[model samples]
Target: MSQLTHRVGVALWGIPLLVIVVLIGGGLFALFLAVVCCLAANEFYRLSESSGAAVSIGIVCAGLLPLVMHFRPDWSLYFLALGILVIALTLPSHRLENLLGRFSSAAGGIVYPSLLLSFLVLIRDGAWEKHYYGGMVLIYILTAIWICDTAAYFGGRAFGKRKLAPVVSPNKTWEGAIFGIIGALFWAVIAGQVLKPVLTVPQCVIGALIVGTVGQLGDLAESALKRSAGVKDTGNILGPHGGVLDRFDSLAAVAPVFFFYFKALGMV
Candidate 1:
């Protein structure tokens, strides 16, 4: 089948499963996210290792601590500190050359997709007392991101001129970026109406702004990583979409910001 076929096929099944898991918002959701973060971290580790950074499997294993510990945020800091310490101490026993590179890359794995992705659990379970509101918020943000990505793709194809960052992502352009943000805002207004008192139109607008703008930054960040590593796609785990990290790069960046947005408004 074609790349676009694979993309649509994955989306057809993946989006529904994701929506169901988000709505569940309990141990099931936590477990689901845990698996995702782990997989993403593994992909990151592989990419970094391929780029001459010596990332240990232990780092990927350690990354799971913060993800699980997010459920009990009381111990989240302690786990993060411990994860770093464990990685640091264990690094010396390895090849001994480029020790710092190994340590930094390994520790970074725990933070990037692992630590950042953990915030999704926070957004899903900690955002609202009403419980379902958290799920709705997640679904809304996800849809906004999708719309933003779609708009960027088509908009760039139709009217791209100035490069957004030609060195990092050649296909991206200023026009596409603007179109993405606009698409996100439009979805925010529509979804906000559907969401009712749970989220006002203004709040959704801000959320969309964050997802649309910052999420693209997340994409570029991953692209930079791939460019440095001299790879086209991160991995083929998602078929045409690439690996777990590639698929969720935007979420890896967006979740933390969105969670904080909820926290700032005292919604969490």
Candidate 2:
């Protein structure tokens, strides 16, 4: 089957499931995120172990950290610090040598999808007291990501010339990246007007540029991870999409950035 066909088929089911979870936005959303973290963390640990890194504790932390952030946002930093310390101290029990490699790999697994993706909970749950606007903001971000990815894919296929990152992601092109940014900017304005009208025109444009660029970079980062692990896809969970990490890599990257962007502007 064609890539486009596979993509559309996946979207048919995935988009509704995601919307339902976003609308629910409480224990249900937390549970959804916890499951995503677990799956992504499992893929990460599998990749790390493929490179001979011993990382078990970090996997546990990755699965649990999102739930903690959902329940106790205040304690997240302390929990991260405590998790790091514990990982550092317990390195010897897992592997007496390669302590640095083990610790760093494990820490990265916790931070990437676990810690960064937790900000989606903040965007949906902690950002505002009102459910409607908060949910809209979450939807806006997700829409921006979808727009960016779609634009990039079609744009690259149609007009790709100069490689964006020849080493990291050979398929990406500068033309595609530009189109992705344009798509994000266009959607940000539409989303602001139709969904919330909370952001100014300038804010929408700037946020889109930032989110679009960073989201692409996040995709590249995951590509680099897979390249390092000497694999094509992270796992087979999503068939044509590869895995949870494959689908959510851009989201994981965008969530923290979007959260802080709104937070800095006092919008959230």
Top candidate, metric lDDT = 1
* Model 2 regions more than 4 Å off: 1-6, 50-54, 127-129
For model 1, residues 71-115, the per-residue Cα lDDT tens digits are: 677777777777788878777765788878878888888788878
Model 2 C-alpha lDDT versus the unseen true structure: 0.82
The C-alpha TM-scores of every prediction are 0.94, 0.92
Which candidate comes out best when scored by TM-score?
1
